[model samples]
Each structure stands twice: as structure tokens, then as C-alpha cells.
Target: MKTLSIDIETYSPIDLTRSGVYKYTESPDFQLLLFGYAVDEAEVHVVDLASGRKIPEDVLSALTNPLITKWAFNANFERICLSRYLREHYPDYFTSYGEDVATAKYLDPLGWKCTMVLSASLGLPLSLKAVGQALQLEEQKMEEGTRLIRKFSVPGLQGRVLPKDSPEDWELFKSYNRRDVEVEMEIRKALEPFFVSPNLWDEYRRDQDINDRGILVDRNFVESAMAMGKRAQEEITGRLQQLTGLANPRSPVQMKKWLFSKDHITHTLCKKERAHFIAHTSGDIHEALVLYSQAQKSSLAKYGAMADSACSDGRARGMFQFYGAARSGRWAGRRIQLQNLPRNSMEDLDLARKMVKDWDYEKLSFFYDEVTDVLSQLIRTAFIPRKGYKFIVSDFSAIEARVLSYMAGERWRMEVFAKDGDIYAASASAMFHVPVVKHGIHGDLRQKGKIAELALGYGGGEGALKAMGALDMGLTEEELKPLVTSWRATNPHIVDFWWKIDRAVKEAIENHRIMRVGTLTIFMQKGILFIELPSGRRLSYVGAAMKMGEKGYKTITYMGVGATKKWERIESYGPKFVENIVQAVSRDILCHGMKNLQDRYICGHVHDELIIECPEDTPVYEITETMAQMPDWMPGLVMRADGYETEYYRKE
Candidate 1:
């Protein structure tokens, strides 16, 4: 057989939502209940492994045959699950991945193809049923998938009666499995024309290997941090109760009533509403608000997730989701949500880490206001290097800003990056026509430049400044509009770039032809608007069209995931499109850096930073030099990297 399309129903007592599939499958109770397959687009077959039915010898051999390609939706699930199934039922057919057969991990991902990855490349839905509906495919996944899996795929409980699976339901379950393979096959065929390049597939393989290798987490720190968080919650909740005399100070209804009693101001007790009420209230009410804010912060829960999600080997796998940002093709954090991790700010982070690892709750309380807050800051320390290894954490400096300058032909901004000068200082110098330096002469002006650079980069104005926490950064209510104006006036080329992109996109979508704006190639094809980046990968806008928007101005409309996270028709203008192009190109640059170093090291990469774990003797400068090497695709685009060596991951 040239190809095998497969899907399997699995059972595991472990909570798959909290712990990832890797930890879930490692459970002793884990097992495969059903296996469905189609060979070379032939008739689909259901192998009821739970009922003792076996896969044929030829197909069993095909699982190990590198010549035959294997296809699946979310291929990682099937590959990892099937590896365990093979080791248990067909050891002879299972290929050894490590030095010893008994110690082997899982099947190699060399010959595997994921239809989900292909769908993401086309900017399609990640779900099988959703993709089928979106593509209007002939064979669709069965709608009863969840019901059947919940009934047959979970373990039986003692004395907990469940409805017996009648003969009809059993047959239906088998058909559900069979239909899944057919739907996956159909999706594979439908998306073949938009296939991701082999280079991208190679990157996917590296992503998988990094996930499979997992990251070593300090279990002692994780567990202690969770315990300290629980204590802090109890103490804060108790303090609030004692101060307010409310039954539960955290309850919105009770807190609202209590606040009204103190200040005669009644409002909704949600986070924003409460903050507004506090800003207007005084004395005990304000104290209560501070207490409530302290109690409601959620940073400690991440440590709990890390403690629970860690595998038996004390490593956390499946923490990064490849192509998680389908639009920009960037990875998103899975378990513990590392992408949104809290920044560390304690005076002596190492001492705090030691105290947490030592489980010295008294010391933790003495040095920290909220023990839970300390625990939250200590999340980075939870990811420790393996024995005899140190982490070389390196990342590009102002990568997005640099790419924006290169694409917009902002010469002065490019020179700032090239000269290794602080962009914020350069921006302040430009906006005020005076010499500026970070924390030096004209240092106070740096705040304006910083806020402007952040808020006005993508055609944002006064509103974006406020949204980006300008007021919190010591800017006044009257300063926002001026900040936006001054920044835009100084960076005229970047502002002009936005409108040019808008014009080119409108022209392309109207005429259904290719148009060039700056370094970007824009075209409309088969109801999709494709923006080709410098890396040769395109960003797709599904169902492209032009419509009069807001005061008779024209705008581009396309189907995309909106703020509500539902796939719907959305609107975009020039600056938003530029944002996408810049981010996508930035992702490609990170990919190039990772590709260059994946052979030697690359434990995990978050945002723009790469975490490398190697021997204590490994030079951090060498890793920094490797990351600084510019890719050939964007020649003249200068790149710089900064890093430091640490026994654990933390910003230096």
C-alpha cells in the first residue's frame, strides 16, 4: 500500500484536559478501543481492538514500513497512541526508536502527514467536522462522535451503572470510526492543492520532536508553589472576611452589598466594574477592593497545572501546539499557557526560588506580600535544565520593529537597530528633536516614545494608546492624542506604508490580479486574498470582498476568527494587513533561527525567545551568534540576539 489513513478511539483514566495526551497515554489504564483504517484509498475497515479483533498482518507490517505514508487528522495523537498500541499488541512490527527496544519511546514521524497541518496552512478550521463543513466535502465526520466516545472510550466505574451498548449502538460506533477515516481521507484530498512545503513539514517534525522530548520541570518547586498558593488564598480570603464581616468576601453579590454599605455606591462586582467602583470610592471600600484584587489574581493556577500536567518522568510534554496561530503559523502554549506567563520581579528571585523549592512557607510569607504572587513569579524557575546542563536563553531584539522598518523602508528606524541604539531613545529623539537616552539625559521623555512606539506602530491613535496602558505608564489623559500625533508625524514612512498596502489590496481584490506594495505581493484567487510574504509563504484571507464601510470608505472583508473566537465574516484595513505580514515574516525569521540550531539544541522556544539546554561547558556566546545569523531570504535585514546562561529559565 502506498498510503494508510488511520484513526483510533482511546481510553485513559487520566484527565486529558489538564494533563496532555502524553501523560494521559502513560496512564496504566490507557488502551485503544477501536482502530479504523483505509489503505491506498481503498474501502474503509474498522478493527475493534477492544473486542479482540486484530489488524491484518499486511497492514500491521505497513505500520512499520517507511515506504508507506501514514495519514491522519492531528497525526501526533494517532502516532503517539499507535506507538503504545504497537508495543503492546505487535511488538515485532514496532520499530525501536532508542538504543534499546525495551526503552524505545514512540514511532518516528518521518512518513506521517497531518491533514490538520494542511488545513492550517490554508487558514482553514482546525477541527475535523468544522473543516469538512467549511470545505463542503462529500463525506463528513459522524455527528455522534462525542456521544459514542464518551460511552465506550472511558473506563468503567465500580457499581456505577451505564446503559448497555446495544447491538445497533455498537454497530453505529464502528461506523463512526469508519466514517472518521473517510472524512480524513476526503480532507486530505481536498487540501492537497494547498499542501504545505517540505520545508514546513521538516519544521513540524522538529516541533514534534521538541514536544516529545519534553522539558524538565522541578516537581518540588511546582508542588510547593501550589501548596503556598492555597495557603495564601486561605489567608487573604480570611482577612477579607474579617475586615468586611461578609460571609464570603469574594462572592460578587456579597461584595457588592458590602461595598454599598460602606460607600453607598452599588455596582457590578466584576473585575472592571469593581475597579471603576474602587476608583470612585474611598477608605474601607478601597481597602476592600485591594483585598479583592489580591484574592482574584490567577497566576498561581499555572503552577498547579504544571504540577498536575507533568508526566511520570517529571517532564511536561505537549506544552506547545504547532500552528496554533493558524493565521500567522505561530506556535501557542498548550499546558500551563507559557505564552502568557507572568514576569518575575522579586528582589532576590533565586532566594524566592530556593524558599519555594525548600517549601519554607514561613520564609515565603515573610519576604512576599502574597505567597501566591511569589509562587506565580516562580513559574519560570519551575522549568529547570537537566543534570549537568545549563539553559542558554537567547532571543531577537525588537524583531517585529526591525521587520516593520525593513518592509516600510524606514531608514532612520533601520539605522537605530543596525547601530545597536535603543529604538525607544531614538524615537524620543526624533519626536522631540532632542538627544535622548534610556535612563539617561532626557530619560523621562523615553516613556512617551515607548508608549508611542507601542501604540502607534500599526495606524493606532489615541484609543490604542489608552488600550495599551498609556495612562498606567504615567501618561495623562490629555497626553494620549499628542503622543499618537507626534509618533505618526515622526514616522511618516511607516504611516504611508499602511495606506499604500490598503490601496494595493483594494486594487487586487477589485481586479482579481496581482499587485505589489513595498516588499509584499498581493493577489486574489478563487475567493481568497493571498498576501505573499518575503519567505514565500502566503497569508490567506478567505472569502475576500470589498464593501463600503464607515463614511463611504472602502474596506476589505474576509472570513476569519474574530474576538469571540467564532469563525465569521470580519473586516480589515491596511494597517491590520501590515500587522499580519510583519508578524508572519517575524515568525519565519524565528523558524530560520530554530532550524539552524535544532540539530545542536532547542529545548523550547516562547514568543521570540529560544531556550537551549546543553552541557555546562556550552558557550552562551556561540548560541547567541547562531541566533544572530541572518537568513538568506531577507538579505540586508540585520538581526541581533542577547542571552545569558542559567541553571533554570529566567529573563536576565
Candidate 2:
């Protein structure tokens, strides 16, 4: 297959982090500053069209070729920049647009391969500099060009392009741009051996396609949500001032002192206090540290940075990141953290929204003690329905848990999913060896069982249970260990699956052989371990090595223990990595389902849920059921999609 590496510098007045590509590149001021490219990995060339030089026919052809794949790091920018070029330069290509047309041909985000994705798939550190350092790629040796990059990226920042530009300035810009393309090509070559599945690439392309053709946005709902959020912000800031005698609630130093010294809260969420809290908490401080602990879960800046995502079209775009968490290949939230949003267990979200919006503080506080969940639901508010249309939401039922059961060959768990039994309650019953009657049927057994099944089964012990907020779910300290043990006893197959995978992976690493476990095929070579799925997609680990376990059994370990780039050290042979892979693979399955829905009904997807905006007369249930059906390739995996049609896109 022919491939062309490309890099372009473009300028836009629109804030990219908020309006996203579609809106950003569409700005009237938007103009490509420079274009750099390489064909078949040759000498990088610069094309300064701003110099009024006639563009070469071959370069033009390479730019528009549907089959000649384009390569760039952060390929989203490339796709959008090229798309702007195509639309402005050629209009006739739109006359007969097909369903599978590259999104850049239609809009933006469709026709490129992101080296960032390849880097993530290999679990390499993000950023071109980091990738270059990790792979030791030579072309990425340029020194501190941040200021140079910004000079070209920002229009009129360095100087307004003259009607006839200076040749020397243009040359520098193109060289810088060309270096990016060359670096991207080199990085992709370095990572080629990792071999991400073509199927996965196809799915990724489809994801970009979905993003290019963004869903219909509801201006009114978004406006209302922001208005209500503003009101809440005022109330919270006012309360904080009254409580702490501080003017700025957003001030970290002020809030930190207030929380620890003035309010007698003792606990803090910053990393500096991590060791202190860990030492003093006596290892069983869930209730005492819930607020501070939750704060630590994400960057404190994210709390205030949420406001920066607002867009001019009255629609907040890029709310959901497509494969943002490349290490696991999970979709992280960009403007809003949609994946980690609070689940709506409460029935009436409308009432909750109204309560928060109308300043009904007493009622809102009574229903949900804190505004975290309320604020989380506000993230969903960023997505709104079209004027005449509404959201037909359909989501897989207990998907990851069900996939765990199916993949583990757990008959009991499979049966629960197959029969429409409450998997959590059933898991509780299985663990506790009780009938698992309704919530009222047992004495605290219900909570214990529920928390145990959800938490401990995934190689989680008391700590994991606590991390999942089991204590906050209202399980007592005395019951934690017992619940953990009972969960291990109940889901024997899943527990076995963990060990089975560990053994298979360890053996593969030690022997340099390919081993199969159920639907997962383990491929080991050198220090890399790959778990290939039935869909031809693979989850890979780099530089995996074996270490001795407690009973002399082999345990797998890898470099880069934590999320930070500099934190490269071996940790534990834990379930965190495995869980990440399974979830990513599961998301792949859901993406396949979305592809299926594309043939009939699918407006877009928000996280794991699909929003199908169809005619009121359409059979929404059939759409939901069809989405729930698993591919023939994955027979053991049971699937179910649950949804409701709403006039507005709000949780039912």
C-alpha cells in the first residue's frame, strides 16, 4: 500500500480546545501557513503556496488520493487542514459522496493515521519528543522548538504574511513543518513491528468519520445547562467564601489552608500530602477521606478548566475523545470527562436538573448531598438534541462484566446475562450463598454482595473494593475481607481466568511461543506479549519479563509502572493492565456494533451509549435489539442494549 507522510501548519482564531476541528478550521481567518510532505519516506519537501508558487500536480494528487494513506502525528490536525484545502479548492467531489467516504473528504477527522495512536498502542510515552526519546528515532532530534511552533501556528503572531512573503521566513516555516512529517514517518516505522490490527485501524477510521459528521446539537439544552451550571458555581463559590472567609474558591493555596487548618478537614488532595495522608489514615480511612480522595482522582485544574470547553455554535464539540487513552485505547473525555461520569441510578434526571438550575438548594442538597454527580450529569448537558429531533439512547447492558463472564467461560455469570437476571445481585447471591432477594430481602448482605461482585472479582482485594467506593456504597469494615473472599469463591472461573491469562502470558514470554486460551491467543516474542482477540485485534505489552511469584510461579512485569512518562519501573503482576486491554477490546466490539447501526440508525455515540435520532414513527426497540446482538465471531459473548427515546437528550 502506498503512503504519503504529510504535515501542515494552519492558523485559526477559534479556540481549538473548545470549538474542536470542525468549528476551529471553519473560521474565516483559518489559512494553511505551510505544507510539508514526503512520498514513500523520501526527502521531505516544502510547498509554500502563500508564496504564490504553483502547486505541483503530484503533490496535489497525493493530497487528494483516497487510497494513498496519509500519515501524521496528531493526524486529526492533518485531516482537518487537508479537508479545509479540499473543500475550498474542490467542490465537485461532494456531488456523489458515498457512505464510506473518508471523513476529510466529507468533513474533518476521516482520512489519516495518527502516529500518536501508534505510539500509545506501543505504550510509548506521548509527544513527539517523548516518542523520539523512547524509540531513539534520529529525525526527532530538533531542540526546543516550542516558540518556533507557536510562531507558525498562531496567525499574525510573528508577522502578517505579506501579499508576497519573504522567501527566508517561508523556508524556515516549511523546514519546521517538514521535520514534523519526517519524525512522524520515522516513529511509525519504529512502531510498525507492534502491528496494530488492520481491523482496529478500520474501526478507528470509522470513529473519525463519526466525529467529522458530528451529531445534531441542541443549542437550547446546552444554554440551559450552562446557565444552571453558572448558578451552581455562584452558589458553591458563595458558600465556600462564607465557610472559609476566602474570596476565591478557585485559589488552591487558600482552599488548601482552609481545608486543613481552618475547617478541621485534615485531609487534602494534592500530591504533596499523599504520603502524609497514607501514613496517618491507618489504611482504613475511606469515610474520612472520601471528598479529598475523590478530588485526587483527577487533576484539580480539571474542575475549573471545564468552563473553557464552550463553543461558539452554542454546541460544545469534542466532548468525547476518540481513543484518547491510547495505552488502553479507551475514549477519554476532552472538554468533559464523559467516561468517568456518574451513573444515573436515580430515575428522574429532569427533576434533578430543574432542582440544580432553579437554585432549589435545600431540595438539591437533600437528594444528592454533593454536587459531583450533579456536575457530572452536567457533562452530558454539553450534548443536546436538534430542534426537531431527540436522542434515542441505546447502551450495552453490563457489557464489560458480561464480556468477562463470556471470556472466562463462567457458566453462572453467562446464564445471568443470558436470562436477564441482575448480574450484580446474582453475583452477590452466588458469593454470599444466599437467595439474593431484592434490596430489602437481606440485612446489609445486599450492599456487601453488590460491592464484592463489582470490585473484588477483578483481582481486587480490600483496597480495590475501597477504591471502587465500596465503603461509600455502605459496606462495613468488618465485612470487607469476608466479602472479598466470598467474591473470589463465587466467581471461580473469572478468578481462574486471571491466573490462566497470567500463566499463558508468562509461559509465552519464557518460551517465545504462541499460546491460546479460549478466544485469546497469546503471542510472545522477544520481550513483547500480545493478546490477539477473535476480531483480529490485539492488545500488546512491550518489554514484558517474568518474575517469581509467592509460590515460585512466574509473574509478568513491564516497564512504565504509572501514568507519568518519567515513571518507568516494574510494579505488580496485577489486573490493571489486563482490565484495560479487556475494556479496550470490549470497546472495539461496541464500535463494531456502531458500524452495524450505521447501516440503519445511528446519529452518534456518547461514551458506550449510542444516540440514534430517528423519526418518532421508527421502531426504536428494534434498533436497540439489533445493536445488542453480538457479532457471529464472538458467540460466547452475550450482548444486550437498553435505551429510551427522549424528546431531549437527558438521562431517563
Best by lDDT: 1
Q: What is the lDDT of residue 94 in candidate 2?
A: 27
Error of 2 at 517 (Å): 1.9
Tens-place lDDT per residue, model 1, 496-572, is 99999998899999998799986688998777788888888888887889977777977789887678877777888
Model 2, span 1-652: residue lDDT tens: 3777877777777667655666677678787767778888888887776665554677666555666777888777777666676677655332213563323344433345778777776666557777787666778835635655555555565665542455565566667677888888888887776677776567766666555555444444444445544555566566555555767745656656755663336444565464455555542232233333333333323333344443344433445555566546667666545455445555667787676556565677688765544655544544555556566888887787877778778898898888888876787778767777665565456667667767765698989888887766767788788877878887788888888777777678888878888877887754667777777767667677887766786567765436564736454453665576568767877878787777643546655788776667666787788787788778767788888887655565
Error of 2 at 485 (Å): 1.3
Pairs that collide, model 1 = none
lDDT at residue 61 of model 2 (Cα atoms): 60
Determine which window of 10 residues in candidate 1 has minimal summed lDDT.
156-165
**Top candidate (TM-score):** 1
Residue pairs with backbone overlap in model 2:
none
TM-scores for all candidates? 0.95, 0.83
Report, for all candidates in order, the number of backbone clashes. Answer: 0, 0
* Model 2 stretches with alpha carbons more than 4 Å out: 90-111, 155-170, 224-228, 235-244, 247-265, 269-316, 342-379, 547-555, 565-567, 570-574, 600-603
For residue 234, give model 2's deviation from the true position in Å: 3.9
